[model samples]
Structure formats: structure tokens, C-alpha cells
Target: MISSDFDSDGFVDIAGLDSTGRYLLVYFGKGANQFHGLTRYWLITKSDKIYSADLFKKFIPNLISLNKLSGKIEIYSFVNRKLNRNLDISVGYYPENLMFDDFTNSRTKEIICYGKNFGGISLITFQNEDYKIQKIDSENTYANVTPIFLNSDEYLDLAGISLKDQELHIFTNRNLRFSKSTIKKFTDRIAHLASSDFNDDNFKDICLISNSTNELIILYGNGLGGFPTAASFDLQYNADEIIIQDFTKDNLTDILFLDNASKNIFIKILKENHEWNSSIPLTKFNNLISFCLYRTRSQIGILCSEAFERNIFSIVNSSLALEKNIFTLSSNPTSIEVLKNTDEVINEICWIDKLDNNFCILKRNEFNTPERIYRFKLLRQFDSYVINKTLENQLDIVFFSLGKNYFDFVNFNLSDQSISRKTLTIYGAIDKILFFPTDHDTPNVAALNQRGNSNYITVTNPFKINPIIIDEPLVSSSVSNYFFDSVERILFYMQPHQVDTIIEFKSKKFNPTYSQGETKNHFRAEIKKGSQVITHAMDLGDTKKFDILNFFSSKGDGYLLTSFYQTDGYLPDSKEDEIILHDKSKIKAVKNDFSKTNEFYIYNENSQSVESLLSLKKGKRILTKKIKEDKEIREFTINLLPRERRELIYLRNNSPFIYLENF
Candidate 1:
């Protein structure tokens, strides 16, 4: 079935087609200012890869045959396309709320029609281009609402009692004979019915609204033919309409009821034990037209209307919270959908409305802030609009109007607290808005206005493009660690090893000298690059030279040595000069060929080694013969200054050991 904002009218008209792809629409409207009552019909057919239709000459005559002259009834086909003239049947009464029943071998279409002559109920069947009507033999004569077909043979008829009280009449078709039975009766009006497995019993449970007492009735049975046991609860609000489905994923049934008395809607959840638990208020509005509940795996869409405006809201399970202010429309919302298994996480919400003399496009975001709302207006009169969501998350909105004309699709982004103001003018009347998936192509918008009685003025075409992208820069390059000084200056890009060194050096020396220190005992140190330093040092006894021998050693031919020296001479003569010294030696240039001589000696024997002594003689060469002895050659070089002494050592194998006496 497809609905259209025909003639850019605020109301959406419904159309249906049979399996053979034929159109059957009723109660058609002409334009924005013309509603042809509930008597017009149009036949649509597919030709040359397009769905085309014309005014069927027999529609008005058939409508007159189905109504009671004084009372009016609108025909609504439950199928998607139109009715096939070859299979069309002339049956008794006008069909309202028509649906198909295919549970049996043959496809049977069921409809509810009421007239003064045909008071009780009637069923029609079409086969071999012939129509047959079967009057349901019942004792009660009242206006029958619609008959709901369950499975193929069983059906439920909601008959009204004097346009006030409602009752459920169950009918079963067996051996081509119809049997009618009154299952449940109430003192209220029956609004709607939904069937689902509510108690995990594998049976279809029926949920219907009793408007007389504002209560919801749940009837459970094994099958449509089995006896049904029912329970009723006072809904506490006047239910103008109600829809039932499995919304909470608990394998139980839930309901959404529209309360016109309070202008509020309520959701009732049926527990696993067949008990109606809590009811929560959904939304409040005035003059609610209709509501639809489209269920997905995760969420449920509540599509409703207040006055002429339509709104769509979603209910999330995690917090049991309802996301509000989703989308609002100036025209009536025709259809709503909660999509499943799309690439996007948020399901798409699409609706059609009328704006001025054109039709407006209404859509909701399905990913990220999936609740972001958008609206657009189109030109030309249409019969139906379809909104399709493809695998790529692209939306296609298509409209079927009487004739093709240029349309200006204007979209707007509104603030959360701001109302949208219509700024564009459309010249042509719009009919319907249809959405379909485009093959990687965006839709285009056009504007056309009436130039004269038969001609129209066209405007420049405008293409709708996706919004812009914004770029943001990172604050810093460092990822793991950060630090700050006393003055609140932040430092990033710190290494792990440097952090250990800073912590160790600070813990060892209490009174360290710093480059910016102003106190006598305290000093400041600033680490700019390689390593940390001790800003101040405590006085450890008189100046002393301490030698700590190697306690542990490895065999890599590399050695590390650490020496400690204490000085008490009123600091150094120059801060740049060495503060502590053990031995002093001056290096001198050698005049002889030191490379040919194997034996070399030094006064400071502590540093006498072949490698050290030869290095002191600048530009000197050294050579050695093939010596097998472990203790062969050892040399050293010594230098003596006025206030300092130095020594260097060189050794070959485990060469000769040197000892020094107190200087």
C-alpha cells in the first residue's frame, strides 16, 4: 500500500494494489482547496516501466452501490498496488479496511462494508473473473468495523454496538462454510487489534482497545480456531486508538494507546506471567489524528499526529527513556518506519507532509545523533510518496503526481529551540513524496510556478549536496606523561628514564646548588635538555678522597668507575675550574721515536701503561712484536700542574702492575 499527499493537501490518502499490480484508491482529493468527498477512485497500472493510472469510469458507480446513500464509507485496500480489472468483482456493500488472507491454498481478500440493507456482515471472493458475496449469518445487526483475518481460515470482526459499545466476533471458514461466534463483548468501542506470541506459548495473542472504559483486553489462545481466554485492565485514560506489538524483547506483548480525553499517549507492557504491569505517558498533543508503532530489534517508533502537525519519537531500552522532540511537521504524517539491519545504527524515520501548495519531505537521521531532523518542500500534485532506505544509507524520496512538473525541494536545519520559517514560494501543487535508493546519486530539486491557465513558469534547478567537513588539530605530541612547575608552566614530551634520574638526584641531595638559587643553603636547578643535576650539596666532614673498589664485575672488556671527592676551600677560585683533584700530571710531547721502543715509564706509576703513555706523546707511533707472555708491556704517562696532577695508563694483556707511594 502507498499513501500520497495528493494535491499538496495536508492529509495523506492511501492506495492499494493487488498481486497482479493494479491500483485501487478511493476517496480521492483534487487539489489543496478541493476534497471530492469520500467518493472518488483511481486505477493505476504499470506500463513501459512506469506506474500510470487514469480515472476509472466505474469507481463512482461502484461506490454508490456499496454505501447507504445517506451514510458514507471510504474504501481502503490493504495491499500495495491497485486492483486488477480482470479480477475485480461486483460484490455487496462498500469495502472498508480490506486485507488479504493467504493462509490457505487460495488467496482470499476480506473486507468490511456496512449499509442499511447489508446490516450484519458480508465476505467476498474473486475467482475466474467472478465476484461472490457471503453474508455472515449473525443474530446481531450493527455497523461492523473491519474483520481481521488470522492465519487463513480464522478471522475476528469488531462490530460496533450502536456506534458506542464494541464486541469481538470470531469467524472460521471450514469446508467453504463460514461459522460465526461471539468471543468477547465489552461496553466500550474497539479501536485496533495486534496479534503476537505474548506468553511464549507459541499461540497468537490478541490485544485490542475497549474505549468505553478506556481498557485494554488481551486474549490468548493456541490458534485462531481454539477457545480464547481473555483478561481486561482499566487503562486509566480514554483510548481513542491503540496498537500492540513486541517492543521490549522480553518475548511478551506491549501496547501503545492514544488517550484523546487527556491528549496523551500511554505504553503498557505485558509481563511474562500474563499481567499488565506499568503504563508510561508518551506524549501530549491536541486533536490527535492517528498513530502507528513500527518495531525494530532495538527500538520502537511512535508516529502520531496533533492538530495537523505530526511527530515521531523513539523509545530506548537501556534506560527505558524516550527520546523527545525528534521531528515535527506542518502537514499530516502519512507513514513511519523503523528500519532493521541497515549499515547505520540509527533507524531512518520518513514522513510526508503538505506545505502551502506543495508537498514537504520529512526525514530523520539514523546514525550518530540519529535524532537530527530535516524537512523539505516539493512542488506539483502527487498521488503517493515512497521513502526507501538502501544498504548504503542513502535515502530516496519519490512522489507520484497526476502529471510531471518541476519541483523545488527546499530543506532546512533548525536549532533545538528555534522554529523554522518558510521562506520559499512554490507555484505548482504537489501530490505525493516518494523515497527510493539512488545508485550513488543525490536527488535534485526544481521550482515551477503557474504562468497562465495552462502554462507554468520554471526556475533554475538546484542540486542538494552533503554538508562540509571540519578539521581539528591535536593539542600536543606527547601521549603518556605530563608535568607542571610551581608557576604552572606545563611540560610535555618527557622520557621515562629522565623521570627516574630526576627523582633519584632530587632525593639524594637536600641542599643542592641551582642556577637560579637566591638562598645560602637552597639552590634552583632547571633541566632544559640531557639530564638532571644536584643544585646543592650538604657538607659531609672535611675534604676527603674516597676510592670505592669494584664490588661486582662483568667480562665485556668495558668497565665503569665512580669516584667521590669532598672539597672545603671556600668554593673554587673559578666556578668553571675543577673543584676536586686526586693526582696531577702535565702531558709533554715526545722528541724520540716512541713507536720502536717497547719499554716506556712514567713518574706516576699508578697510570703507567703502554696505551696511556704513548697517547700522551702527541703524534707518536707505537708498534709491538709477537709476544706470547700474558704480562708483557705496560706503559703510563704523567702530567704535573701547579694545582692539579693527571695520569694515563695503557696495558697489554695482564701486563706489569704498578703501585704508587704517598706523594
Candidate 2:
């Protein structure tokens, strides 16, 4: 039996095999104990083994059956209340068991079959319409094989038991190929094998049940494709099946085994000291055929299946003695989705037997309370939706994309229990909707638009009635994108495929630390259309690009700002301001204060002429600032220190420049 959310509605559904009748029975789960839609489909007969997998990654797990008579794998998908065979591949021979795992990490599972008559394992993988089959370990016979990660490398390896050789086979996967590494001298017959990282280490550890001695063996992996250490625990009953998982939610792996004699499930919890606790009975039913881990988003339970019904039990006081509920079935199940509810606080659960069909909703957790069960025909699911508290009154506004060119805006009022929806048609296909917070009561929205083969930008306040859309197309157009700074009422835009050219604008922010009660912060963006473009070039001699950091302008004249670097040399006390350095020595930095603007240069090449030269004085740093708006003579802030470098700053004119007061 296999369990999956066949309708993609989060609740678990069951797909069971009726091999005797050659039919696949499906029961879509409505809730914990509620089910409906007992539908059946003709597939394979009693000799076929059924397994459920999402081979297409399409959210719905399809039923796969390996037919021994036909020697073919058939996949049946549940669609529109009918099970349809989607894929059929011939394997030439039937194997005893099939394992589904993504050995190639390709998101789709590959079929690994073992216990064949030819004494080997075969791999079947599907890519598009083509399928590839490979045979591995054709020499040895494996009773059963499981996927494992034996080494530190993150690849799936094969772990199997060979009853004839009385040995455990570990096939390490290297570059997608498996090579057998044997572990011999297993005195007892190994019945079941499972692997997990029991000690919280990244290495995979193995635990097997020996039916002959009725002992459980533990093999600790050293993470180098070896299980050198072994431990054994005496079991009360013979277990034929083993499951290794973290059932206790403690991050450490635990072992659960089903006793073959009494048909009872038991779990051995792992402790912090890398030891196993005594086996605790986990089943409340008798004559159970099989069991599995039943999990949902909110709870984990153990599901035990019998001939007529399935019982789900949860851990209450660390035991499954208190059975939750038993769900009866008309026929035995082959596969069932236990539960896949994802909501944290589940008020109601909904499910459908077929995709896009009528579904049933059931209220949960109130067993004695009479609740209404509703059956509704499925409506169209929205393409995309986003909710935000964007209004001043703090109500949630949900934006749902109905289609490419239409959007439905929903405003929900919890106090009044009312909802208002309005549809808006956009100029082009809406790629994305971005909401920018504004100081006003209504939030501003920007929608990225794509019409035909070209992209554009549409800016508007979507909350306003008869909202104006400022659509700027970028196709041989000057504007590629635009952003509206609502506070300044300035629209900044960029040209098509332009990245290098930029515009820097500063806004005055209130700050008591400055001379005035405010300071100006420099904000930059790509230059918009109809903006002035400035071009200038300079060569600072022997100065690295990182030495010069920021550039700011005040009233059209640009000032290149930087911090001075210290040289690596010895200094004399008599001439402390000067240092002698080696010619090939590296310049040592004093302190990297990225905001320490200690040096500045008057390098406004656009305002003045180009290709003019200036020299840097040794052991001195300069800072230039305009003292008054009308004054042309720049004020200088100078500090003398030992720094080894002379730079040639480019001036606009070809004339000799000299320092008046400081030199």
C-alpha cells in the first residue's frame, strides 16, 4: 500500500492494490479518520507489486506497479476520477523487489531492482521519453538491497545481505558506479537491513535484524566505507522488517521493527550515549499485515494495516498504547498517504479523489462535537497571490493575479466579516507587483510590464480611483525603468542597457551633530533622461584605485575625497615628519576608516579645462572646501604626517599651481 496527497490538497489519500481482482483501489482521505471516493481501476493482477512515486515531480504521486507476468513497469496517475496508465517500460525480467531513489540527484527517482534470477541488481532511469537500464553486481545474489551513503562523499551506495555467503555487501558509489566492499562472518542469518546516522554524526550507520538468533546487530560506520565496530542486542521476538528513523524527534535515529510471530510493532529508542533502549511495544492491534510511519505537519503517528481496517496511533506518554482511531476499509489497501497537512493550526482539512473535482471538507479534533461536512465543487485556483497590511487602518489587502493582464484586489475586514474585491486590467502582462511604502495613507505600487517581446515599467498608486499608469516602454526608447521618489517628487529613470552612468543626489537629514541642525546624505542612482552628463579623466601617480574612495560635489565643483596611507619605514625623532622607505617596499595602512575623509582634491574637470597637473607634497595631506558660495579661492585643511607617496592630480588648465598659506 502507498499513501500520497493525490489531489495536491495537502490531506493524505490511500491507493491500495487489489491484486486478486486486478484492480487498484483508491480512497481519498478527508481527515484523520474520514475518507470518501472509494474508486477502483483495472491495472495488474496479484503477482504485481505496487509502489507510489512522484516520478514526474508534479506534486501528485503516481501508482507504479511491477508486473511479473508481463515483466514491465506500469505507472498509473489519478486524474479526473480515473486512474490512467501514463508510462509503461519493459524490464525483460522481473525482480523480487524495487527501490525508488534519486541516485542521480535529478529530482526524479530511478528504479533499483534486486533479487533477480540472474543473481544481480538492475537500475532503471527515465529521462524524457527515453529510459536507460544498467546491471550491477551480476555475480552475487542479494536477498534485499537498500540505498545507503557509506562514505563522506554524498552519493547513494548499495547495502545488501547475502544469505549464501553469510556476509553483508557494501557497494560504495564513486562517480555513479558501485564497487562491492564485503563484511564477512555474520554467524546468524540477516533478515532485514536499515541505515541511518544514529549517533548524530554525518556517517551512515547500519542496523540489521537476525531472524535465526533473534538478535539485532548495530554496525557503526567510520565514514570511510567501513563498518569496523559492531554491537548486538538480544531481541524478545523475531523481527522480519526494520525501519530506521528519528521517530522521537530528538535528531538521533531510532529503530522500529515488526515482530513476525505476534505481528506487533516495537521501537528501540536511541539514547545520547550512543546506546539503544529496551524494545517498547508500539502497536495496539493484532494480526497486522504491515505498518508505516504516519506523519502530518502537526503530528506523527504509527499506522498499522490489517485485513479490514487501518489504525493510526500517536505517542501519548511515550507509548502507542492509547490508540487514536481506526479507519475501516471495504477492501485491503496497497498504498495510502497517511497525512500531509502543512498548516500549523489546522481548522479544517479538504480533499478530492480526482484533480479539479468536487472535494469534501471535514472539521478536525472535535470527535464528540457535531460538525457540518461540506461538499463543494472545485473552483479555479489563483495563479499567484500576496497579502500585506498596506493601508492606514491596518486591514490586509490581498493581491491575486487572475491572469497575465488582470489582477483582483481583495480587502478583508475582520471586524465586519466582509470582503471587497476589485479587478484591474493592466496595460501589459504583469511580471511582478512591487509595493513601496509611502508616508501617505495609501501604499504605492510599481508593476513591471512586458508587452509582446519588449519590457516596460508601469508606476502608479493602485489604491486611488481611476489610477494613472505612467507606462515607459524600453525599446529604442530613452527610458528603461523608472522609480518615483514620492517625498522629493522626482522621477529617476535609466536608459536601455545602461549600467555605468550614475547620478548622485543628497537629501538633508536632521542631525544635531553637524554645524547646522542637519546633515546631507548622498544617495546615488542611474542618471535619468534630460539630465546633464559630465566627463572627466585623471591619473593619480603611484596611487592605487582603492586609495581614492568617495566623490561629492557642492555647487557644480567636484571634490575627490580619500584617506591618507602610512609608509613602511623607520622615522627619526629629529625629523619625525619624514620617513625613508625602500624602493620596492609595500605601503602599510595606518587604519582603514572607510568614512575618514582626511584628504580632498578640487578636480572639477567639467567646470574648468582638462589635462592640467598638480603634485602632492610629502608627509602632508590636503583637504579643499569652498568657504563661501561666491568665493573662488578654496579653503584648505592640512595635516602633516609621514606618508611615502607623490601623486600628480590632474587640473583643468595647464598652469603652475602653488599653495599660498600652508607652504
Candidate 3:
């Protein structure tokens, strides 16, 4: 329901649209505090407006109506005894609300229409006395918008709240331009906003009703048009709508809220100092929307529309609580969706009155009961769905063979909590099923339908009713194809193969440079593959990376050769010319002295393949390696983690270490 002086009279008039009937009714106010009605059999606009107060700069009083036929807004101005054509407002599909306010705080009101589905605000402010429609930067989806004075100035800013992300967006005013807004995220969804002077500060404070938490958050406004951080208070009751009124007449504002607890109207009385008190009276009604009315000079009553009917609750004496049993609903209501398209515009609450059988629009008849106008059905089930999937993500698409090979894909709608089914054609008891995604704009699933008795991979989908079959090695992990090629079930299907593992031995606490025992047989494990014990090989080493080598021979002579990768570190620095092994007698002495000490041995883990170790003793350190000095011999040893091979040499008297270059 909405109110404006429809006949341009001094008294305020009421207008309501019966959701079931789709007719617009204008309650033209008669002078003596009364109204005579005029009805038009038409679809009520999604957002309604009546400029009873000169809203537009044109000073033209207009009545806004959404043409249900064209989905266009038709504004009518009161000329004679009735309303005539004045103007029409347009936005994309479903303009949520229309309001006339000084959005720029420029002392002039402009016609503003907010777009809900198309996602922007139609700010119809004036430029040089001509209507200029400008839009603010907005998201593709938003909840509601309001012009608020938030800063310490007279400029009007915007606050657009979105339930999608639970954020309150603040759009600062920038004179002739629209400034981008900032968002403050909240934990709870803000359902509605009502302004009142809750504290004694005398500034209009903002109260937002939480849809989920059932709490009313009050943001106290400073006198300089700014508000501090908000504070929350539990309402002790879940409310979908709240209206401020001075029911106690104590100058403290009291709230009349629609409590979902008992589907009722509950009055919360305020103290003399504007504080909410607990304990409110409960009255039940399936009210879609309600407006408070003064019954007599002293008695306050409430007018409520409960989908199919209306109710009037007279305020009890002294208590200010509304009494039940003035009226009731004629049918059961499903749910209500609130669309705010106005600045302080209390408009109609579109209702779904009938649930069963033929649906119709309705309003009050002669006996104040809902009268049906026409009948039609509104859709209940969600028609289309999207099966969006990324190949990396795992979503279950199990096909249960319903006793008789009647297959169905699980079709569940989480929004309405309903279960439905889509047919899948698969026969002859499938043993394995795998779902894989194909490259497509929409999600496409490729299923591997393997039969219990066959050796083929069958893929099924909506378009391809007959399964696509591929014949490949059934014992393989996956079918070898241009697409997906691997599965544990196929790779391990009753077949076993021997794996040759080269187990390089590593010391536990023993040092790699000075270990006593050989590691070739120290650590060993046997692998049994289908009754065959697979023999493994182990390499023993005393160092991670081998470099320099020097040995004193048995003849008191020196023999030396070093790896090419790095410089020889153990040798003394500076003297390039020394009494070294190059001399024939010293080379023979060193080769003879260290011949026995320069040799090491190794036994394999299997007690087989006896590999030798390289003996290169520098000072007291001796590194064990499997390298042999013979040209035809294998490497003495290898290192683990990063494996490196090394070889050793023994010098005889004929071809001795007289001059060794690279080893």
C-alpha cells in the first residue's frame, strides 16, 4: 500500500494493489477525514510513486504506475477530479523503486528510479531546469539504495547495501559528479533499514534489521551528518519489518515490528528515555505488509494485509498493544519478497495468496474479506539448470541401475530442496564408471562406462544416447587413446611383474669418510613378485662427491692423481716445485709403501658380485669407493641421493705413478 493526495486534496489519500486481482485502487480522501475509492482493473506497478509533495523540479504533482501491459512506468498528474498523463519513467527490466529526493543535496528534488535486475541507479536530477538522467557506478547486483548525509556536511551521499556479500556501500557526493563508493562488509545480511532518533542526540540514526541474526543494529548519527561505528542490540524477536512510532507519547520513538515468531504483530513499548523494553504482546496474522492507523481521536489501530485478506487491530487502552481478531487471511501464503524502490516510499507488498489449484489476485470485498479477481498459475519448479564442472574438481555423478537397468542421473535442486530425475540409458550391469570433463563452454562430462562382461570402454552423455565404445587392453590402467590414458584397477588386474630396484646403501650414524664395515651387504630387502624373489644391487661409498687422491707408497715415494671437477685441497699450498713423486726413486718408494693400504674391498648385499672399494688415504681419512684400478673393472662404489662413480689405480714398477694427469 502507498499514500499520496491522489486528487490533489489537502488530506492524505491511500492506494493499494490487490496482488491476486492486479487492480489498482486509489482511496480519494473526502474532506472530513475520510476517503472514497476509485478502482482501475490493471496490474499494479512493481514500484509505485505519488508525488503528493512537489518532488520533481517541474512542480508537477504526479502519480507513478508501472504499466503491467508494457512493463513501463506511467506517471499521472491530478488535473480535474482524477489523474491524467504527466510523465513516464523507464529503466531496464524491474526497476525496484522510484523516489523524489535531493540526491545531490542541491535544494532541488529529482526523480530517481533504481534498477534491480539491470544493475544501476537512474538518477534523474536536473541540469539547467531540464531533466538529466545520470547513473552511478554499481555492481551487477545490489540490494537497496538510500540517500544519507554521512559526512560533516550538507551534501547528500548514497548508501547501497547488498545482501550478496553482506556489505554496506557508501557513495560519497562530489558536487556535479558521482564519486565511487566504499563497502563495509558485515557478518549478517541486512534486510531492511529504518531511520529514527533512537538516542537523545536528536539526529536521524539508521537502524538495519538483520535477516539472519534477528538483531537491530543502530548507527547513531552525529549532529554533523556523520555516524560512528554501529552498535547492535538483540530484538528478542525476529522481525522482517519495523516501523517507528511514538506509541507511548513519551517523545521516545517506539518500533512496531512484524515478528515471524507467531506470524504476528508485536508492539515494543519505549521508556521515557528512548530505550527498548522487553516483554511484548503476541498476536498472530500472516501479514505481508502493515500500516498503523488512528481509529478515533485517541485510539490507535493497525491496518495489515495478509495476502488474501486484511486485518485491523485496535490499540488497547494504556498498553498501546494491538488486539487480535479484527480480521484474518482467506488463504495460505507461500512467502514474501520485499523490493525497495523508493526513498521513504511504503508501497505494496506483492502477495502469493493461493497455493493450491487455480491461482487468482484478490482484495477486500464488501465484507472486508478478500475477493478473487482472476486466476492463473505461477511457476513452482526451477526449469533449467547448469552442470558446471572443472576437470580438476571432483563432483560425484553416480548412475544407479534401478533394479531393471532403468538409470537416472541425480537431479537435486538445493534452492527449493526438491529431488528430481533425468533419464540415463545404460544396460547390462556396468562394473566401472568414470566421469571426465571435455573442453566446452558449458560443463561437459565424458563417462567411461565399462561393462561387467566386456573388455571395452563406453562413454555416455545426453547427446550421444548410444555409448561410445573403445576396444583396448582391458588389463591396462586406462584405455590408450588421444584423451585420458591411466586407472589402478586395469593396471593391476591379476598381473604381477618384477621391478629391478637399485638400492644404494646409506650409513645410519657412521661417517661416510671413515666407516669400518662395507655397506654392500649392510642393508637389504627382498621383493616377492608372483613367487619370484627379485634380487637387488647395492653400491657402497664413503663420500658424497670424490675429489683429491694422495698415497705414500711402500717404497717411501708419493703417488697422486686428482679429480678434474675441483682443486686438490689436502696438498700444502705455494710450492709448485717440490721433492715429489716425479723422481724415479721416490715414485718407486711411495708406490711400494702404500700398495697394500691403497686397496679396499666390498661384498654385495646378496653375497654375490664382489665389488672392490677404492682406497685413497689422505692423512688419517680413508674414503671407501668401489672403483678398481684395472681398465676392464667396474666402478668401485657409488653415492646415494646424488650418486657419483669413482675408480682407483695401483702402480707397478713398470707403469707406475711417475706422472699421472687425470683420474
lDDT of 2: 0.51
Winner on TM-score (1 vs 2): 2
Please report how far candidate 2 places residue 173 from its true position, in Å: 1.8
lDDT of 3 by residue, 40-131 (tens): 53543443422343655444455666532343666566665554655555555666566566766564577556544646666776545356
| Tens digits of per-residue lDDT for model 2, 474-549 | 3323332333333332233323223445543322222221122232323344433433322121222334121222
Winner of 1 and 2 under lDDT: 2
Which candidate achieves the best lDDT against the true structure? Answer: 2
- TM-score of candidate 3 to 2 decimals: 0.42
Comparing 1 with 3 on TM-score, the higher-scoring candidate is 3
lDDT of 3: 0.42
Return the candidate ranking by TM-score, descending.
2, 3, 1
Local distance difference test values of all predictions, in order:
0.35, 0.51, 0.42
Worst 10 residues of 2 by lDDT: 649-658
